[model samples]
Target: MNKIISAHPVGAGLKIFQNDPEIKIHDDVLYIPRIPGPHDSNYGIYDSYGRLVQTAGPRRGWPNFSLGQSQSSSISPSSSYPRATENSYFYGGHIGTHFGHFLTETLPRFWCAPHWYLNKKIICHSGDTIEKLFSVSWIKEIFEMIGLVKEQFIIFDRPTTVISLLIPGASFEENHFSHRQFAEFCNKLGRKYAIDLGISDPIFLSREKFKSAMRTIEGEEEITSILRNKGFRIVYPETLSIREQMGLFCSDRLTSGFVGSAFHNSIFCSSPRGLALCYGNSYSTNFWLMDQVNDANIQYFSTPTLLLKNSPRVGVPAEFTVDNPMDVANLVIDYYEEKSVLKKENEKINYGKKEGPYLIKTKFNSFLQIDRQLGKIHAGSGVGPRIHKIFAYVFDSQWIELFTLGGDVLSMDQLDSVSDTLNFKMQISQNEKTFSLKHPVTSRFVSTTPDGVVECNREYARAWEQFLLISANQN
Candidate 1:
């Protein structure tokens, strides 16, 4: 059997030093070329007689030597082989180290999208304080649930991004003591894990841009009073934007807020380990929108908070009072710990399942709700032809035709005219099979025959029912 020997200096050049002087030495180390597949470089180094020795790499770095031999004849090494040093070899970086950087960079980018949309792109509405509270809690819960603890490496085989929300004017000044306590808590955790607490800067809203909104609420005085009462230092609004304001909440690994704010969106998207505390009140609109923005498989923890109240004449705001901050804190802690439990439950429920149909159902539900609201279809006589035109513009041609022609609404002449112009028609045969207009619209029509139509509808309904069941099972 052939063996690799360490290179030693023989005069001006290097030579391999073998215990058996009869073994020829190469330039530096001996080389055995053309080894069979499935055999390592060190293979066949020993024989049954216990003769050959195998040494790999340079003498300084790879000093260890071993022997392996078979019962058959021993092989010799080539004299022209060159020695390899430790520096010449390539080794990959540690998975944990790579993951840490990925979480730091990509997490922030994902979370910042919602903030970018609200503060820079959309100008339809401004966010509120209650929303901020809910968002903070949600983010904290999601992080804990995902098991994003310090020093632990999470490998994401697929491409993924994080999304978080950052409230514009939320402050930790009133919770200064809590902030300090949290910082200490993080420090302790860091020490135990032998990891560093790498906290990023806070994202806040631009105070100058929202001067009118800020002034209307006498925000400065109210915020200062609340902070002082909560034993936190008073923070000025003008100092940062909403994105920056989120820095305070994320001072620790744990943080939370409502589902609606751009700040919350940014944080949720950016956090490597993110939690989202969703108030049931905002689930219909804001939370749904958040789900669209993040796409991070966000773990939602429900908080028992009222979003709206009903009255006979005019609607009034729900009570915004909290009796105990400690209770809220305890809830936040418990939520994070429960994230793993929820994730395991989710895996068990969704195991061996396909996700495509569920995604389609979610999209359909959104389309249906928006269409009903915008078309005033549920408002009795209030809806007119103009609303139908608007709906046509809002929904894709396929969806418009699907809802319009599949229902009894086709009896109306106006809808027929619209369908004709749109080059779409929905017809039910004697066998109860549905067919679409010929050509381009056929693909959009979902089903073109009675049995197919029934089957398609049943499939969609069954998929939707399964989705609901999965959701219920998760809860």
Candidate 2:
């Protein structure tokens, strides 16, 4: 897998490791061909296994701007420091600019995206009293849920695991990570947190007295009054706690807000009938909010603000009133009317709640995950292989389906199956605490082959046949 990209090393004398690296290494130390800066996050040191080789002292994006404190030293990039101890793991990530950062950039990097190497511990910038950065709570909940709360997380200001992981940021490389996969993780967490904290009244996201008040709507009071008079309870989302905030928004069916961080909370809301957004010309992009809101079956309507060119300030909707107020009000009214009709129909169908027969929830082995499995259903045409685990879902017809983990379900075959063996009965052993999966058509139990092939050719269930039905869903 190694090809010498360049015949000469940039430095005096160094040996090329593999691929066509930016530089060469020599001795016990790797004399970097290019000297990096203090805040250069692009530095990467890798092993043969493709894992990032960690270095001591400050990582790139530290002093978490939110935390206002970093353990990184004041040493210059030219000075020599102790290399990261062999096998020493760490927690690392980015200090993103906005709410969209948490949804699209931050959490995905931490939990769902590929890093220099896999890290169990995480570092966060916490704030219990502060009004900004709702990230710490989300980080904590994730660590706790993943069974990593014991020693897997570290916060800049708070006490947790104080290690640093050598992971690259999105800027260092392309984020081939799946957005849909990240959304599923959020959905799972939203459901669990929502269940813990009871749901609340329909929320009207108000930025009237919020910190980022510049981007607020023109005549916001009138707009808010229109919503309040209808049914929305004007809510300042930043004032409340994370769990409480999630519960309030997740439970509501209809919502409206001037496009900003407050409205980004719609990430927790699942399958809503309609969501209204008002934005200024300067605030052209909804950021990752568009992905979350539109994905939830929420009917979206925008009141576009247009004004004179070269306006220095952004999100000032009041300065220009290009769109008619009556038109905006009509759209809002029409949306609510549709929302009302949809809610009743949903009630009749019991639409939102997922009903299933199989109970697939538990703690899986650390290095191995049987909680979810994906392999060649068949190596023949139309069958496939995947990077992530395959998911199982129960349809309205009460049949089990093998769904794609990170790819399109339809593009890959959504294999529907009904195990006819023993009428879908599993040989669950209480003494051993193991269960075996049986293939109905073959009548043999599912077994792992030496070649990593999932086969049902075994006559009797053995160690490979036994499986753990661990119940952790990324939604």
**Best of the candidates, TM-score:** 2
Candidate 1 lDDT by residue in tens digits, 1-475: 1111111111111112112111112122222221323323332222223233222111111112222223232343332323232111111111111212222212222222232222221100111222332244433332343333222222222111111211221111110101122223222322332222144422212222233311121122332343345433433433443233434343434433323232233322322233343333113222222232233234444433322233223233222323333343334444445533332211011123222111111212221111223221211112343433112211221211223322323121111111221332222233432222211211112221211111111112222211111121232
Query: lDDT of each structure?
Result: 0.25, 0.39
Candidate 1 C-alpha error for residue 434, in Å: 29
Query: Residue 138: error of model 1 in Å?
Result: 25
Candidate 2, pairs of clashing residues: 90-164, 90-165, 91-164, 91-165, 360-471, 361-471, 362-470, 362-471
Task: Give TM per candidate.
Answer: 0.25, 0.44
lDDT of 2 at 329: 48
